[model samples]
Target: MLKKQRILTASALIAVSLMFGSCKSDYEKLKASNDVAKKYREAVKYYNKKDYNKALDLFDDLTQRYRGKAEAEDLFYYYAYTNYKLKDYTSAGYHFKNFAENYPSSTRAEECRYMAAYCSYLDSPNYQLDQTNSSKAIEQLQLFINLYPKSERVADASKLIQNLRNKLEEKSYADARLYYDIGDYLSAVMAFNNSLRDYPDTKYAEEMEFMMIKAQYLYARNSLYYKQEDRYNQAISYADQFTEKYPNSKYLREAASYRKISDQGIKQAKVLVAEASVDSKVAKKLAKKDTTTGQPQSVVGKQNERSPQNQ
Candidate 1:
């Protein structure tokens, strides 16, 4: 019984090896064949059988050989989709876009253009990564909509554009918010303001406005004495605008606190600026007139009237 079982297993292995060898031999013959038509037929067979890697290999070679022929357009379209099915979206998008542009009169032009944009959308990475592909997808999708207003894919393209737009908005918002987290208050203030300006309808509007107010207040509080008055006033302005825009926002209370802080900061900054200005003028006058060895009598009298420290 053990000898018979060993024989059966050995025979099965031999049969499997022969089957693979036969398939490999056939593939070799197809590769070396001068018959483009035969290769095209085999590629389509493999594609229909869901063997996209094999189909892609065959189609990639055929596309270069079959250029300018009647079957070229169909072959090119299939070639792009074969790459798409194999998860090579970058190549797929490029070829599909090329097909649409080169064969504008083809019945599949609109579909190819849509597929090109869809491939770009598929290739778009997460928002935290560089969004170059997502931006390109938006451009491609918009172009498709412009070119094919009557095509059924236009609605879907618009929706896809909106989705990519939201991703971009999120990326921009996160980047701006990061400045605040890192204690770069001035840059955070500008970044948040620019983000809001760019995406007025972003879902983060309330949170962004509140954070912007906080950033502005912190920026003012840390600024030089001369600059703090203007900066704190700017924070107060931002808080006022935020409250007017979102009175019932969840951040309203926090926004009001920033407003109060900004108001107090503004008064304190103004007083500091005033004192610094007076001290600067006094120091300048003392420096210019105190050319005497020890101290000029007039300057010393002025210092006594004010304070000897000012001298």
Candidate 2:
């Protein structure tokens, strides 16, 4: 009885294997066939089943075959979406843009254009990395808004652009802060200024302003005595500007402290410079007197000349 049951189980397993093999062979045969409609239908079925890889393959094959035909527009649309589904954003972005450009009159043109920009947005890296994609996303999104002023997607596009801009702002702020962290005060000051200039309304404005003041003060503190007065004065000026611009800012007290320190530094530097100037002048006067008097006679020579033995 056990041997008979084992034989039955073996037969069932073989039947299942054969059925699976036949199904796989059928798909392979369909792929090799030249039946355009059948291939397109199967691609759509695969797409609906969330089999994106298989759908992508079929769409890739059918794209050129349907070119310039009525089905081409829909085919390209599916192809772009397929790439998007596969997380191939770069290719998706290109195909989406191509579809919009090729079919400007299509109702889906605006959507595709927006998707192209969104793809670029999605491709944007972290704020700590390169921001080229963020810039590109902003440009694309802005263009989309300009081209379709009445588009319902305009609001969303605008928001996306703002988000990208914020990312860029963060990158700028981080880069400037890096200079500060590394004790490059002068570079930090310049970088902070640039960040503010580029993004006047940045959320980091308050922190950046405060850091700029501190950086300038440190830069002045590290300067040579001759340059200290001017650099410290500059720091004081920056502090004053910060105070005036953000009177109620949380950094107000710290900024005021920096200003006070800078003022003290300027005064000390001026005094030292004056003392140095006086000392230099006195030294010059003594050197001149020595030069005018010629070489002095040694005391031993004078004593020897006065002694009777020398006489």
Candidate 3:
């Protein structure tokens, strides 16, 4: 009887061990499924909580583990969004572009396009920088417009591109104008040239042309009398360009008046330079004569150096 009792106990122990093992296997399977669900839910939860880092980490895991799963599309969008929120613009741009390219027919494609363009825009630096990123952003936004013409974001994207272009235009104009104001005519001329070349359609083109004219005029005005003829000629050429381009410009009368003054000044300056050259020669000769004599020579100093016959 004791043997039977021991056998029954052993049997009971075996059955219980098998039952526990089976339960452990089931539990592990359920835990894994729930873990994936939990992580996904937690990603959303953290995103809502503005805990972007945690959200991003979970998103990264979801994208890697469940890329072909049912929730892949949802995960992809959130991944891009999280990067955008973190201001990792380069990553955000790539992810958003990927989403848009792969899921062109998806409902989120439009958003992805917009976000991608926005990320590129965010990557753009200030106007003082090289502007390579700014140009990229403009191109992306323009492509977004072409791809999604009916999108609600179209108007805003167009306006943003215009604003960026305006910033570049303004920076160029300001740099050129600063040179003009400081009398750095050569730099001003080059800056204006670049401004026109880069943004010929800009509203500031008129002002740029006007400034070029003004800078050329000042360059002529500041030149030495004998060397001013070329500068004045260049100044008049620019003035004529401004007049032809912007006939109704507020500066037309001013430009016309400046041209007259510049022409007259060139003639007067030439005459003054010639007379001064003659006077300088005469003075040098008188100084040599004065140096040769030990006695104080007051009589020759008072006499006009020019020959009386020429006078």
User: Going through the candidates in order, what is the number of backbone clashes in each?
Assistant: 0, 0, 0
In TM-score terms, candidate 1 sits at 0.84
Residue lDDT tens for model 1, 49-125: 99998888899889889999999998998999898888899999999999999999999999999999999999988
Candidate number that wins on lDDT, 1 or 3: 1
Question: What lDDT score goes with residue 177 in model 1?
Answer: 79
Which whole-number lDDT from 0 to 100 does residue 181 have in model 1?
79
Error of 3 at 49 (Å): 3.6
Pairs that collide in candidate 1 are: none
Report lDDT (CA) for all predictions: 0.81, 0.84, 0.76
Query: In candidate 3, which residue pairs clash?
Result: none
Off by over 4 Å in 2: 274-311
Q: Residue by residue across 1-311, what tens digits does model 3's lDDT show?
A: 99999999999999999999998675445435548887788789889999898788778877877777778888899999999999999999999999999888999999998989898898888787777788889999999999889889999999989888987887788788777666677678779989999989978888788777666656655555566667778777887888898899987877776566557656765665667578987445433321111211111223321111111
TM-score of each: 0.84, 0.85, 0.65
Relative to the true structure, candidate 3 reaches a TM of: 0.65
Clashes of 3: 0
Q: Candidate 2 residues 1-311, lDDT tens each?
A: 99999999999999999999999999889889899999999999999999999999999999989999999999999999999999999999999999999999999999999999999999999999999999999999999999999999999999999898889999999999888887788888899999999999998988998888777766766556667778878878888988999999988877877777677777776776677687987445333321111122221224432211221
